[model samples]
Target: MSGLDDVIAAETSLSEVDGLNGRLVICGYRLEDLAGRTDWENVLNLLGGRMLPESAALRERLGMARQRAFAETRWLDDGIAALSITEGLRALMARLPDGEDQETALLLAAAPSVFVPALIRCKRGMAALPPDPALTHAADMLAMLHGRAPRAEAVAALDTYLVTVSDHGLNASTFAARVVASTRAGYTSAVLAAIGALKGPLHGGAPGPVLDMLDAVGSPEKAGRWIGEALTRGERLMGFGHRIYRVRDPRADALKAALARLGAAGDVDRERLALAEAVEREALAQLKVKKPDRPLQTNVEFFTALLLEALGFPREAFTGVFAAGRVSGWLAHAHEQIEGGRLIRPQSRYVGPKAA
Candidate 1:
């Protein structure tokens, strides 16, 4: 009660944070299991507590949602003269019609799969690839981002990434989403709130800088010295540590294993995989010596950079891809919050000027 007990509450289905043991679980399943064995759509269904409408029904609904989401991409063209990509995305998402219903909720969640990649591709003067009306959500996203349908391996890797991130209970952005949803706002409203929260550097602006760090270091040999300098400057390493995951981020290994499968099948760049392995070894070893008292481990963003980079996505596009997959979880959480019948409003203790 002294501090923000809402932040530390045992009930709220939030922050099952086991910092001492370094483990995170969502909805009673290990992050590793979803990331390793399932596709994004399946994981979404798991978190959402619904089957994906039997394959045929899912494909049909997904096709319709893709059309709805893709049409919004045109708004970005007008933004070429004015607004930034994130702003444009905010604008487009805001325009999604309001409702707490499941149909509109799916559309709200699927919008970024169509919009973000289209905007990024348009900025680079590349034509935006259309999503297949028949593919699963993750597959369609990868197809829409890249002209050729992603290889099976790429789809698998992306699916795992999505599963890893679908929802981590009341992560900052998801909590923002629930806050809006609790107001009986439409699903789009909830997701828009989540997107705004996610756009902040402290919350989700990570993968881009991870790529930048990798580019700056240039090779495995440089990782140790570079990390030492970064530590000396009291800088938080972009890909190291997390609010959860004390021993190692289970998601990191999940995603890494996903990438390894892609490498096994020859979809990922060999050199990139080699570089990541070297960085992993050097980073772990050096982190031990540099911060002897604290535990620092690789989180999802490190391998996420390598995987998304190999998948032909630009570093700037990384978070957008994250959004594409996570929106499902957002929608689910939104729906769950509404069904549970509680406003997400929490209070803070007065810590300033009480006497005054």
Candidate 2:
């Protein structure tokens, strides 16, 4: 029962994470097929059980939802600005009215994209920009954050990241969303619960630290020495392993390829990318030698850090950005749980003292 290993909590058709085979299928499409070739709105539509062409309508709805979230949460003053990015998002999301419909889902999904950038600006003493409904979801988010239109390559990279992390089979945050939804509490409440779970270090928070590790290693030549020392100290390497993936994480490859594309467009630091690749090789070799029995290869967070940093997101806001992408899956899972029409309560055995 520890860590609920192999527990079948709920059946879902949204996305499947095949850890053994290093494959990810989202709504019947392989992740590699969707990551760069499609937009995040299309992925959202697919998760919602709609056709790919319906992305146009979903894009417009999401745009309007962003506008509403921006207008209603205009109270992002010094009080809210004092909080961390993720905390600020949670505070704003708490203001959304309770509901379980698609409209509610759209609002919940849009809140992070609006609030994360706005919070980033607020922290820096700048005004928040409004969403441009005409642009794609990823482009608009980048435009709002940077106060201008982003390059096409940047948008594509961001969209790929969103699609890549949109959903994994019953991750901690998605499960939290489902558990809250099983009570029929509303999509907003469920999404809020998911964000809380994602804020934890073991879940959606590792991407930021991955950058820190890279900075500490400093260069490819030092990578082996730094990694060896760190392993000697028994510190867990950020972005290196996953609870499910025994082989290399497929999402890591997807994002790495995205990073390479961004570099090709002259948007990313090629030297940094090269250093990261060298470090990855060193880390994998070290892991293999240190723990021969364990198959600890690279996971999604490895390239996620490099890609998002290239896209100009601050490290502290990484998890909030992750929530923005993942809210789609959370909402979809919430709807699925509501349809099942059962409470998610589980029984636990007594391990403490028993009463007479």
Candidate 3:
């Protein structure tokens, strides 16, 4: 069965999702290799590929894109006191003009602009912090969010996150972007469509719920019971299971290992990591009882919540940050779509009344 109740797209090279075997490939690189080691700029380079010049030119291009996006935060000229980040983001989005070439890259780079400033504006009861063009990409975002630069490890962790999520093959959001791209819509339209798709409960929105589950379970000791109850009620465990990656989210191990590299494995980190593992095991056990035919396993969201919490992003910002990374994939797809010059047109068998 297909996901489209609203729209249809034939195919695209944006990314591939292999749900049964638990594999995801972005462009040509496996996700695990790219997550922690590659910086956002590097991932952007990889995604943009030969279209982006190598070395200094690439850095200069990313720098330009970042600055262009940074400038867009000024569009937050209205709405306050009660607007949600989603509302604010959609509003700011409207200010951007359509003629911008491959508009997806700018939107992708602007994820920090949409999220970081909105975070501060909501918290500070003011407009928001301006983007600091001088800082590195992740560092600038953290600085905007907190009104100061982030610590080294935290910055690195965020970089890991952006790189990790930069793209995934045929995820709901990326696929949506490709679908829109197939229609030959302007790039920004495709990106906006992707963001709306991702906002769905089934996609990137799962991280915050994972955090809540962790809190309710409260300890590693209660993990098994929590899993049992959630399964009993037919409530899906937030962190466990992937539409792709049957065994594990390869990104999970990659991110956990990155967290270890922060060298902050004090009691808090250790406990969080342990509880995460415990939850994974118990969830798997319960899933075996309930869903024997298809074994569900841990997705990246479980550890992503813990890790982002450790890095000081509030639970609310988790999905926003995910948007920040996924925009990169959207841009790549936009570029591919534009170059192909194929107007995305698909036919569906009509099941509704039409004039004969």
Candidate 4:
């Protein structure tokens, strides 16, 4: 039972990660159908069992929720500002009241967009900008972070990223959230638990390093050499490979396409995207030759690094931005676990010394 590989912890209709076939289905729609075609709000509604038409109302409610969460920024201080963005988020989220209602879910989902930007501003000695309730969620997040309205292409790219990551089958953070929710702790607590789990490097922390790897590689001409040398040193390439996906991760392609679109719209650095693509190719070629048995391919974190970097987020804030998209999934999973009404208590075999 190492790492619960192949274990069916619980049943969920939220999303399915088909690592074998290289497909993702979120609430009956293939990822490709919804990712760039629709907005994150619609995907959020779909995961929550609401009809797509209701996304408009959900958007409005989420907007109001962000406004409400903004008032709590009065508690942000020098101590909180000194912490990492994710930790700062946890500290602020602790102030939220525990509850298991739809309103609480919206609040939990909206909290990251509010708190992350505020924490970034506070860290830089700038005043936190209030969220505009009339703007869409993705737009408002960029707007709040940069203190201006985001351009249309940036909004679409951000929205696509959020939707693409809205949910996946029982990832580490989602499982942590569900475990806490099974205890009836409350949505806020469950979300807090999920955020703590995502803080780990193995889960949500590699995107920043992906950017670092790109910086070190510098140009497409050096990609193969750097990748080969890194392989020789027995180093794990940051964005390639996954625990479950034997094939290329579908989310990776979705994100790569988003980055391409951003480049086409002139909102991102086209040369940077070209460099990333070169790096990806070299990494894939080197991985195939070196690993041989393992199908190590690019994962979501690869393009996630590029896209977020192009969008003006620093490396340290990458995980927090990931949390912004993932919170919706965490809330949905929490509600589902709460509805199931069973504590996620598992038995562990005592392999320690048996003699007494």
Candidate 5:
């Protein structure tokens, strides 16, 4: 099978990615129904069932975990100056104490928020700020990055981003997390493994490049000509395709909605957003003309770039921001996989030789 196409690797209650119909159902709720209505605390409650703390307690516990994770930021060494944000983050996660307890899981989830902004500050020669245990996860993260308390609307926008990407089906990084969990490894190791997988360009790295594409296009009038020339040279459009979804990605819509609201509130450039909307329409029309049989509609990367940019994150730090949201799902998946008590050892078909 090419890239394990149509293979059922494991059963999960985390989230469902319906590629045919372009719907994402997390736990028992539709993504559209759950994403904007709730925050990460409630999402974790749903995914963890009885394995995690209650929503109120989980918030308090995660706040403490974020403070605990501050100690791990000392691993942001001189060598980290040469590494990407995600690389620095993965290296820091590797140094965390390895364990499978709820403390370990919460720490791993909180570490990304703690480390990502600190590394960015370190790169800029600024002292790393400490987390505010009293703030919400989204608010604390933005405050840490900007060195002040975040605006309420900015916090809301980031909360939506986190909840939207909290979980999906067995994606590359999530599968890596589960495979490590299957070995009965500590949740920290599983989360570390997932971070490594997500660092790849094909997985968690596309959003930043989507920003690059928009920069190249420059204006709405230039979008069609720019995309055409790129396609003629066999360049893959960064945000226009997906691996599974035959229609538009549901996460794309969720994020677009968030951006629209942000734009309406004057938090972002409405003109730039209008240009992106034009690009999306042209890209979809061009994709249809190029590959009629294959649906290459806009995926999550499209709006992820716009939303994160609106949230004031630099393009390079986009993947690290992604890890912050996704670690929640990774911990949940790791815990669930560990309970199965069966190692994920799959058989490989030997087709290289016909010897007996």
Candidate 6:
């Protein structure tokens, strides 16, 4: 069971990752059916078992939650500021008033939207702008980050990104959250644990590097040669493979479609999209010949990079943005684990020094 592959750790009515079939199901709705059909507020309401208010009301509530979480902005200690985005996010979450209530969960979900833009602004020596509680969550995030009203296309693209990443089946971060919550720890503690898990390169950290890979390859004509060389050197072609899905990731297609929408609306760099499509084609073709037995296809991380770049986020902030979307899923998983009423205590077989 190396890497805990194929392990069934818990049961819940949240989301299911059908790896072989390349399907993602949230609650009862297919991910594809929900992607362009709803926004994050409604998605949260769906996963939260309708405990969350309706979309319009929830938008107002989350907007207010963003403002409340903004209060922690003043507590951005030097240590927090100096850390990486995910680390800084966890440090900031640790500073929130400890609680396990729904209100506290909402605050945790709202905190990243408030803080990520501030962190970006702080790094550039720009003063952070206050949240506009009236704007939709995605629109408000873009406005805060850019210090101006964002294009409607950009807002739509970011909303799709958020909704696409909101929840997946028992991912590492969600599992970490559930494990911590099983111990009766507060919601903040569970979310902090999830953030730590997500910071690892094997998980949430891959998308940023996907951009780096695309950059290094430089052009469409060079993509095949570049990927071949990377494979020869045993370097991963970031964003080209998934741990679960044997086919192209559904989220990849979802984000790619969002990027296309932006491109059609004249809001994104279409040349870059063209290059990415070429690279993806080359990567898939080369991967098939290189590893005949393994099915490695473009994943969510592939288009995640392109979309976030289009939306004005630095590659470094990718995981933090991902956490912003995924926090709701963590909240749901933690609550489910707590309600399940069983502590997660898995036994490990010792393979170390023997007792002779």
Which parts of model 2 are misplaced by more than 4 Å? 50-56
**Tens-digit lDDT string for candidate 2 (126-216):** 9999999888889999999999989999999999999999999999999999999999999999999999999998998889999999999
| RMSD of every prediction | 2.7, 1.5, 3.2, 1.6, 1.3, 1.4
Clashing pairs in 3: 15-169, 15-170, 16-169, 19-244, 22-245, 22-246, 182-344
Q: Which digits, one per residue and each the tens of the lDDT, describe model 1 over residues 68-159?
A: 88876666664551555565667778878989766786677668878877877787777767677788777787787777767878877877
Assess each prediction's global lDDT (C-alpha) against the native: 0.74, 0.90, 0.70, 0.89, 0.88, 0.87
Ranking by lDDT: 2, 4, 5, 6, 1, 3
Model 1, runs deviating above 4 Å:
1-19, 50-56, 80-84, 354-356
What TM-score, computed on C-alpha atoms, does each candidate reach?
Answer: 0.90, 0.97, 0.87, 0.97, 0.97, 0.96
lDDT of 3 by residue, 32-77 (tens): 6677767887787777754455745665555566566656665555
Clashing pairs in 4: none
Mark the regions of model 4 whose C-alpha exceeds 4 Å error after superposition. 50-56
In candidate 3, how many Å is residue 107 off? Answer: 5.8
What digit string (tens of lDDT, one per residue) describes model 5 on residues 201-302? Answer: 999998999888888899999989988888788899888888889888999999888888888789999778978987898889888998799899999999
Query: Roughly what TM-score does model 3 have, to 2 decimal places?
Result: 0.87
| Candidate 5, position 241, lDDT | 80
Scored against the true structure, residue 51 in model 2 reaches a CA lDDT of 17
Better of 2 and 3 by TM-score: 2
Task: Put down candidate 4 lDDT per residue, 192-212, tens digits, no spaces.
Answer: 999999999999888999988
User: Clashes in model 2: which pairs?
Assistant: none
TM-score of 5: 0.97
